[model samples]
Target: MCLISFFSLIFFSFFLLVMGISYLFNDFVLFIEWEVISLNSLSVVMTFLFDWMSLIFMSFVLLISSLVIFYSREYMLGDININRFILLVLMFVLSMMLLIISPNLISILLGWDGLGLVSYCLVVYFQNTKSYSAGMLTALSNRIGDVALLLAITWMLNYGSWNYIFYLEAMKFDYEMELIGGLVVLAGMTKSAQIPFSSWLPAAMAAPTPVSALVHSSTLVTAGVYLLIRFHVLLVDTFIGQLMLLVSGLTMFMAGLGANFEFDLKKIIALSTLSQLGLMMSILSMGYWKLAFFHLLTHALFKALLFMCAGAIIHNMNNSQDIRTMGGLSFQMPLTVSCLNVANLALCGMPFLAGFYSKDLILEVVSLSYLNMFSFFLYFFSTGLTVCYSFRLVYYSITGDLNCSSLHVLNDEGWIMLKGMLGLLFMSIIGGSMLNWLIFSTPNMVCLPFYLKLLTLSVCLLGGFMGYLVSDVSLYFFNISYVNYNMSSFFGSMWFMPFISTYGVIFYPLSLGMSMTKSFDQGWSEYFGGQMLYYSLKKYSLFNQIVQNNSLKIYLLMFVLWIIILLWLVFIM
Candidate 1:
């Protein structure tokens, strides 16, 4: 396993270097197509696109996968099925790679379904009821996107080819192509967990922390963003684009708000990932595809680092994930705590960090754009909420007094895990600056008022202070959570999105099914169609049999009626 990790890391690094050079000098797109079958001017072709974007993205995917695998060596050491776990992780990464390189919708769907299927397997790896339920939610939520992708592929059939890249520009304004574009956006939204589809992301934390690091950071969640970036031509200046902007903005705000209220260590990080994904989607919707992509890469670096540190902490703490039970870990595990702090601050967009470069630029671009008031508020407020949650996490997990029992021992003893985290820690600190230089040929020129320029920093500081104060025990008489229990629960529960995504979505359909079963299968159709007909036929058949028998009672009744009629006629005369 270690050998695999070492070789994979070296291979990814080499390719990343090669691709970076290619991106700088050549910047060319290479398309490979082989016709599998053709009939009547229609061709079924296997298509792969190797451009700077796809190559670089694939490199990052492999790079992160290698590190996660390295980290998992120590993390999953006690599990008897370690080999199977690693195999599943590799499969997940391969699916992501297939997704990144494919230009054809049919091929993309192959990779897309692979991701959904493997993710379900990984999510349910623990074989517990919680894992099973979470896995179901995760799989079902993603199936929506899979269905959308299928619909988009079917729409692409109208274009006479499954290669969507050929029709991206045409899809922008063509009335007939808008539906395909809309389906593409829907696909991206569900895969990326935007707005109403977001409930699965946090629930996915039931998986092993290594899976969380890989899935939340680079592979699964970001697939949607990457898809949107590819389809940006269709989204720009369109109704679907505007709707994406609104939904993504709401998602950002909702995730940030939920993160502040969450106590689970992995869950808080998961929510933070959702928030960043929202930022990426929002920028993509605004036609800043490059900026969104920039953020995506930088975010992957730090988030992976963050989750690795989280995984280490959880491993040492006997698998306790509740932040409330942790405190004063800075004394024992200085290295892990430092890495965690760096990742956290980077997430908060501290100056000179990876997150700062892309995030600040995104904010500046958003401010410069002619966006509505709602979007502007969501952007800044979500930024602040990000800081709030990070500080809250830091305080509870690192600074507060040890809240667990005295028998517990916590330390950064696992050198293997530490090595894995250290790789990402360095990248988290310097990655944004490096990527900034490589991605943007010319720096964007944005001149804004001093106060407007200061807003991002101001919000960060203000959010930090608020997080500290809100978390301080002295600030409240009762538990702060109890003061606004209902509201806190609402925010913490992600606006009841889990219920909406799982129960709410299925409730009406299932209810209607039951109603139909009762009314038709059991009631009206049962009686009126088959059973009622049988009863009617039986009654008529009995009456006919009696008539055929020519019963004496029936003959006597007929004679009596005839006599009565004759007597009446005689009386009248």
Candidate 2:
């Protein structure tokens, strides 16, 4: 069944590629709608919009997923639930396809919910404590987006239709539309792991690496960016767009810093994914939707290949993920090392590689744009940090002395895994140029000064130097561990975001609830109801016992005294 699905996706990818090319030239759309409900002038319909964008994105999703699945055949060879894994991958791909094609908010929810649920399942596929916690974080973070989409859908009820494609243009000028726009941007932030929601992406590395290759690298994380690109018409010139621009810039810088500080191989790659997501969000927020989408496609190819390379190395090393413990495998696993180098170079945006075509163009465009000082610094800083982390990763994992014990045998002999990686390797090599040509027939014009033109290259060189210095010499000899403990720990732990998101968000509220329960419900209720009642009853019973013994004797004596007292009272009156 897995084999059938794999080959079918490959064939379908080619078919969609052809269709996408045809649609690019002819500019035709295929729309299909089926009414599901109608009442009092309100109706709901399942709507699919097939255009070049959907076709192209769906093709890439399917292609990457198919390759990941094939790779998993070897990567997950000894697992007991391989079939379940394959099914989850297929379902994830299907959800992504549904997300790509949907034009109506209602139908888009189907795909959106599918992705959240399927990804949660895949994240917890390992059933360990780490996977469980990561899955909870992943699901809960994405649930915020789900709720936002639900609110946005409810708001669309005012327009009498859930077809967001039709409403985007007409609603842009409407003040009420900002509500939906803001909600949509919020949704995108959570899905893309922007700002407060950023911690989940790295934590989700507890899943199997094949799942990471698909979910983090391409389909799942990019869903948010793709949705924003689709909604760009409504977001242009809005406050929400401006807010997104600021938030995304911060996210890009934060993730790049986190990646540089990270030592785990998969977490580093995951942080890189977060950084690229921020780049996509930042570009889209700046109204360069096409450029964002272009980078999205190209980043997907190389990042998937990068994860696969990481997976191959991890498999060879008996599942060790710490880059600190890995070194000098370039000779032992030549093919895997070569793929890793190519992917890393592509990630660094080296000329003519997959990332260069989109990343360089994005930097040039940003440099030419009239951005704020903070955004400007973020753009360049994040760009340099990308190089820094790529060099850092290479220095630790590829070029250093071998750090493993003598007994462990490591080799790049997984033929099936290599086959899967080779497919994406080819695409990562050519995807950038191909996407650039197809997406931008006429290149964007940027009138930057000479210094700005060379800024990217210059910063890249500085980043490389800094990366090597930090990873090799500074890590060992720089006695700043005590001096810069707080600063180093802050960046190393992703600005304390995971702690803030998990414990900070939950702790106070939970403590308040516990206090309330103890003070009001348990403490007060027990005192008033049980203890007070019991004490009052016991006092009454003791008084009754005393009265019973003294009653007869006191009555006889009191009769004569009452008569005397009555006589005395009458005389006084």
Candidate 3:
């Protein structure tokens, strides 16, 4: 299985290169249809749509999955279920491929549900309390999206077909189509972990690092953005589109704040993923679908690389994920540190890196658009917080005093892991520029005021300063201070979203149910049925007892009266 996975990796890399080059000269598309059920005016058909977007996305998914499989070989070396792990990853990749090629809602559901179920399996693979809890949260949260998609499929019945692509262009003005658009947005939000559904992304760190890298980066999270991109044409000038813009912007801001307060290395990265997803959704909500797609592809490259680097660090650190327990590892693990720095800088939109091409373009386009003050604040503030948390992470993990009591013998020596990371490292450096040239064909023209032009750089610099001040060794002296306690707690806990999702949503409902049971089932029903029947029977027995006691004297008098009455009646007759 390992050998097969390795060969598949090479084959996919070569194939992606060939197809990417071929796409530049001539675009190709394929459509295959099969009739399923047909009545007078109703039809249900299975259809596949393969275009440049699908091909590019599928190639990247394959590339990342292949590398993840190779990396897992070393990461899961002694595991008893290594074959199951590889098979699950393969299944995940296949499901994503199915989602990419399908234009029909029903077909998309097949892939969507496949991803949700397989991801649950992967999350719970460790067979521990943490994994089990995380898996349930992940699965159930995604189930909401599955339900939304099912509703969307049902609503499409109004149009007499299940193929959404055919109607996306024509249904822009149809009022009934708003329901589908709204449902799609709701479904996308759950899958992408936006705001109310955002808790699952961080909790999902319970999965193996490779699964985190693969699922969070490209397959699971990106699925929502891809779906939105597919339906972008139908969302223009719609109320749901504007609502999505607001929600996504807030999500971006929220995730960035959460990252700054996070300590776990993997969870911090996960929060960063949430923040970037928000950015993509924000852009898509603004009707720049192509820009969102461009960022999605670029983000997948660096984020997958970032997660792999974190996995290497965690492996070397004896599975300790807390950043506070780590320091000054750059001297021992140079390659891993190098990759980490590159990926982080790329995430911050550093120039010439893969992230810069998409991220910078996104910011420029956002600036040019006419937006309200709230969105503007969110866009820039989130950008600043990204750099803030990133530098703080670097300070804790890459530089500072060696905080470990006893250092384990560590080095950047895992050949398979390094090889896997190496594949994405170069792409993280050049992928953005290559994709920009291929997708845009020409650079976007921007004419902004001087202050606006310098806004991102200035905010980034300010955030870097704040990050340094917070991480400085002297800040430890102020530990006794209760300053900003509530604020810090809020940010650290992701605004208590996990609590709200679990306790707030579940606890109150369950509490209400218990109260109802006590009031109706145990209280009212018992009183009205059992107690009332018992009391009525007791009264009847008392009446019978009184009648028996008085019956002897009353019987004799009644016999005399009865005889007299009979005599009078006979005379009258």
Candidate 4:
């Protein structure tokens, strides 16, 4: 099964890559439709769109999936339900593919729902309380996006078609189209783990590392970004677009801050993924969807490599995921450490690496645009925080003396896993430049001032130095003197986002429900509505029966008494 799946995925990836190149060079978009039903003037059709973007995205997805599967073969070698795991992963990839190619709202919902459901399954694959809770959080959070899509579908029905590609241009001007655009943005936010919906991304680290590498890092999280990219025409200059900009900027800043304060290795990477996602979303919201897509692709390559390296490290360290327990493994696992450093550097937008091309372009574009102070600072500061956390991570895990027990053995001899990491490592180094040349076809001339051009690099250097200093024991103690435990906890806990998303969301609704039960469902509603009506009817019925069943003797006695009283009154008058 592994062999067959691997070969098929690789073959199709190459095929799609070639097709994508052809499509891009020719400036072609092919739409194929099969009608299922027609009523009056409306038709229900299943439609597939083949364009450069979809084709290339699919190829990348397939390539990553193949490598992740190959990596998982060794990662899950002794698992009893490895087959089930593989099938779930394949289903996830299929769902993403469906979402990528469909221009129809109905079809997109089908794919969207598939992704949410399958992801929940994968999240809880380990059968533990933590996994189950994480799975539930993931499923419920994504359900919001699903509902948004459903609303979008319902709204699109008014336009007499489920295919949204036809309406992208019109939506910018039409009121209803704007509403649909808003809904789509909402959907994207939930799926991409932007703000309020952000907590689930880290919680989802409960899934196996392979799933994290393929699904969370590269594919599922980016689904929302891709959706917005497809709908960019409508969102380019609208209120919803601006709203997305503010939200995504906040998300980016929040995630970057959270990553710096985190201790768990997987959670830190997850937060980094969230940070990068926010970057893509912010760019997309600002109307540079092409740049956003570029970042998405580049991020997918390096982030996947990051996860694989983390997986290898965890595997060697007896499944210990805490970074505090790790240090100085360079001698034992040089290959993994080298790849890990490259991936981290690529993530930090080091020159010529996969992230550098896209991230640098995004920063330049953002700097040139007329943005508010909040957004401008958020972008640059977030960039710095990203470097800070990354360097801190490297410092703790690869530079200091080994912190684990002397009896422990750490090595990177798993060639099967290393093979997958190496595949992505190569891409992490060169994928950005290759993709930039192909996607742009022409260079972006950013005529920025010298200071602005140097800003991104300067922040990165400052962030790296701070990362090292902050991780130092004496410096940490010095900072702790000023920084209280609560402040540290707040930052470490993602600004209490998990609590906000779970308790903050659930608390009010559940409280309202309880109040309703006390005031209505179990209280006045029952008394006035059901119980009051029943008592009123019963009282009236009993009175009527008493009148109907009156005795004749009693009636005669009362009639005589009434006659005597009438006579006496007549005489007095």
Q: Can you list the residue pairs that collide in candidate 3?
A: none
Candidate 3 global TM-score: 0.87
Q: Give model 4's TM-score versus the native structure.
A: 0.89
lDDT against true structure, model 1 = 0.89
Can you give the lDDT of residue 307 in candidate 3? Answer: 99
lDDT of 4 by residue, 194-240 (tens): 98899999999999999999986668899999999999986677788
Model 4, runs deviating above 4 Å: 37-43, 473-483, 506-573
Local distance difference test, per candidate? 0.89, 0.89, 0.88, 0.91
Q: In candidate 1, which residue ranges exceed 4 Å CA deviation? A: 37-42, 473-478, 506-573
Assess candidate 2 and give its lDDT: 0.89
Candidate 4 residue 417 C-alpha distance from true site, Å: 0.3
Report the Cα lDDT for residue 194, model 2. 97
Model 3, span 1-573: residue lDDT tens: 976986886697568656765764587767899888999976767898867788788888888888889999999997988998999998998899899889999999999999999999999998999898788888878888999999999999888778888888776777778788788888989999998999999989999999999999999999999999999975567778888889899899999988987789999999999999999999998899999999999999999999999999999989999998888889989999999999999999998999988888888888899889899889889988999899999999999766888758779999999999999999899999998988887778889999988888888889888777777743576641247788889878888999988764456766898999999888899789887899999999997887688777777877999999999999999
Tell me the lDDT of model 3 at 198. 95
Ten residues in sequence with the least summed lDDT for candidate 2? 501-510
Task: Score every model by TM-score.
Answer: 0.89, 0.88, 0.87, 0.89
Output the worst ten-in-a-row residue range by lDDT, candidate 4.
473-482
Per-residue lDDT of 232-270 in model 1, one digit per residue for the tens? 887788888899999999999999998988889999999
